[model samples]
Target: MSHSPHNIRTASAEARGRGATAALLIAHCAGMLDLVALPVWVGAALIGSMGLAPAQAGLLVTLFLAGQVMASLVLAPRFGRWPAQRVIVGGFALATLAFASLFLVQTYVLMALLHALGGIGAGTALSCVHGLMGRSANPHRVFAMAGLALGLFGILVLGSGPVIVEKAGAATLFVLFALATFTAAVAALMWLGQSQSVAENQADSSAPTSTQLKAPIPKVVWMGMLGIGCMSLANAMLFSFVERIGMDRGYGLQTVTSILIGVGLFNLVPPVLAALLEKRLAAGRVLLAGPVCQLLLALAVTQVQSLWLFAFAAVVWVGVMIFTHTFLFGLIARLDTSGRALAATPAMLMIGSAIGPLLAGVLVDASGYQGLGLMVAMVAVLAFGCFLRLQWATDNRAAVVPRSSH
Candidate 1:
């Protein structure tokens, strides 16, 4: 798939615009960076590394995805008329408040409450940061930035957070995270300017200039959401529980953690490559891999129990997850040039994300890690079947469009 340099001119204009887009992503996601591993790292320190149960630790992510679902479903639309910056700032403010509570709150209930709030903040921030990416002169560059950020944070959390915990303790980490998120939120509003507001951005540039306006959803787009959802569900299940899976199998907790951290390095590779191939492969080509990867990885799980086997499975499996996510966003942005409807796509992805984790949790509670992995693998099979149906439908639709117009 031609995912990169779609129409790249070696000229400075493209390069300059890319620089500006990366700056915007960094500025907007600062809160994200500031608190990257704060919750888990801090929790590990305060709760005692052994004190943090796998399910409990997984809940932190689960709750966050739940908030993302609720926010995406409820809050996102109401703010459709606001600037993307408003959401960014509000998310940061909320995250800061949550972290501030962490500085003192010690009860599990209290931590859950704050984490739930932080998830909402994370959901809002992610949705908006992604929306901002839609405005880039080169959308792939923005995707690359996102991949870079996620990878960097993974490194910080998996690698550096442990060091910080060893030296400074959890409370100190909370205070630092609070400061950083607050700074990011402030910077987003100040630097992005007011013109980037959602209400002001209704001009439909993606449509033919002579084309009549209609509500933005095309059948193709909804189908795209399905694929995206499947990809994220796999990612959430794997990311939140992969360590649990490894540890249960006999690896040391520290070794499993290190393996998970090593994941960040690969996470960086896919988006850059996907962006390069995006133009060459239609968005569907990239998204179609979601189910394909899931199908193989699911069986792969049955075969491989060793640490190396899990690691090997992760490489392409993670790529499939990243492919679905990155391309889904790219496709949604293409379909809805108007900033408002486009905003919902992130929320949809989050919704899928929430479902995956909750299901994983339920399965784990019932059957343990191996069973949970198999259940997720089943879901992947179902999602792949859906992808095949959608692919056929899309081809049929493309075939009919010319005849219908004539």
Candidate 2:
């Protein structure tokens, strides 16, 4: 019995879909591992082992994010011209080298430079994955899966990272990061090419352009990006200093860590829930719900004195973050079909993450945790307004197009 041509094509498509999913998951997990793990361990190492001032340690993280912003702005837009697989594999290789170089560096400046380089690698890998997801059949589902993978990694790393740092040293964390990136690099070799093909095919089918020209990005897309950035900023402001806040409330380090672990474990819930709910609710509604929940939670935490209450708030905060991020990326995909908007997501998020701590630090120094909470609440309100406008703009655009066609 001979297989029909249509049957063969269906089987081929199925194989490609599986390969693309695997590649996207691996790339996303690799790209985000450093983002999640480095903040936990590297900041402590800089202060405890290297004797850097807290401000200087903060600057190191900023420089690393600066590298990511630079790459997302400079390299990601050019993915259409470059081989996606090569870019991803090269990014992993670069990240591995940068992490390994951390062991050799003793000077603050050198370490900062290496961290920035690693950020570039991470940004590149992340941009490739985002572009691929945006071009896939269902970007919302892809992003949800990506969140789930990151949450799982966060659980393992947050659970064991401090122990590793305590037992061996902070430098060993870099070694583990190197090994993770190397593993991702190896896996990338197998599936990234297939994923790239899927992206190209989708691009051709959706918007075939002469000489690879792209539609001009709309203003609403930029607004959506700004909204996500603000949301991230508000979230990070409190999150970056949650441990200090707990300590100020008289919780011990062990208790604070336990709360954080619970936060990490609870991280797994939102993405899975978002994936299920994406079909039931409008994406804009889901996006709007996140900041609303966050603002209310932030207000509640400000008045709560109990450690358990704070822990509950922290877990809910993580859930809101995962939910917001997944839907926000999906919104970008909808706003800009060319994939540029989604590719810029990491840059926007990193920019906000980079700014939040600095601003929050200043607020805490001047006004204390209560003041910080108030300011974060205000920011969340602003973010919600942005999302509201984005929804309106999207609706108006949809309305205008059909009317103009008539």
Candidate 3:
């Protein structure tokens, strides 16, 4: 009996369903630890009594993003031939160490170095996760799964991290995150394998680029990228600076955690809705829903004063973020008709991710938190335009649902 790659059983409902389950679970579990670790760490770093300055504390955030960028850009392409699961597993183990480094290292400089290393691992793992989501047979389901997992995991981390931080101290709190990372590593080992063949599936499955080359870059993709960047920037701003926001607003640490957790809970909705949809929609629409939600949340940020109101807003913001990113990533994955799509997406996303926090950081420094929040809303306008264009561009391609976006 010969197994032909073209005639793989992955298309069967049973196989595809199982694949989606595994993909979703693995992503959700790992995402919980890695995603929450940074901001929690940021809070710890900025507030720590080591007399570290904001810029110095900011190094941890910078290193994390920089490491993620390096991993996604410099390493992901290199790991093209390696099984995604393998990369993910190794990445998790590295992340565990990275998390541990902060606890064990005394100096900020050393902690930054450790964070960079961890970022390498975390970035690679995340890239592989994104790659896997892209490689799925049911693109919508896969993307939705990623979104759901992200929301669920965000809930876990944000909801849990602060309590743990308060009870166990920062280092011990990280130990718990480390355990989560390790659990994800084990799950990946059990469920994910090298033969997952993400590279092959995406390369072959993505939409064609022949006409794309002849035509201009549709401005839609650029717009989409910008929109995502701004939305994420705002999200990052909240994640990085929410502690200060709370302090300024006379909120407690528990309230801060509640706010973050609220975002996670609200984020939990879109993936479910996205997954339940009967008709397969264009990736752009799928992606657009998230940012649109984010824009709404961003606008409502100033209006919410109570813990409950803030929590509701946070939940919505996070949900929007999960769905939007999951949608865009899936789009990028499926866009590899000409094979350059994967390489291009990482750079675009990384720029967006890094720029978001940096912009927020600058705004906070110059004008304060309210100014930064306004800046986020301003960026969302740009994102909306981009999402609109991308969706409009897809109106002509009725078959866009069945294939990639290149």
Candidate topping TM-score: 2
What TM-score goes with each of the models? Answer: 0.79, 0.89, 0.78
Superposed by TM-score, candidate 2 places the C-alpha of residue 50 at a distance from the truth, in angstroms, of 5.0
Q: List model 2 lDDT by residue over 143-255, tens digit each.
A: 89888888888777767766666677778878877887787788778765633754333443233143333567779887778888888777767776675677567786677
Ranking by TM-score: 2, 1, 3
TM-score result, candidate 1? 0.79
Clashing residue pairs in candidate 3 are: 227-383, 233-356, 262-315, 263-314, 263-315, 266-315, 267-319
Better of 2 and 3 by lDDT: 2
Provide the overall lDDT of each model, using Cα atoms, as 2-decimal numbers.
Answer: 0.59, 0.73, 0.61
Q: After TM-score superposition, what is the CA distance of residue 136 in candidate 1 from its true location, in Å?
A: 3.7
lDDT of 2 at 308: 75
lDDT of 1 by residue, 12-60 (tens): 3345434435445554344334223422442345334536654565565
Clashes per prediction? 11, 0, 7
Deviating ranges (above 4 Å) for candidate 2: 1-13, 42-45, 48-51, 198-212, 299-303, 403-406
Q: Which runs in model 1 stand beyond 4 Å of their true positions? A: 1-20, 27-56, 75-80, 162-180, 197-214, 298-303, 315-317, 402-406
Candidate 3 weakest ten by summed lDDT: 336-345
Candidate 1 yields a Cα-based lDDT of 0.59
Model 3 RMSD, rounded to 1 decimal: 5.4
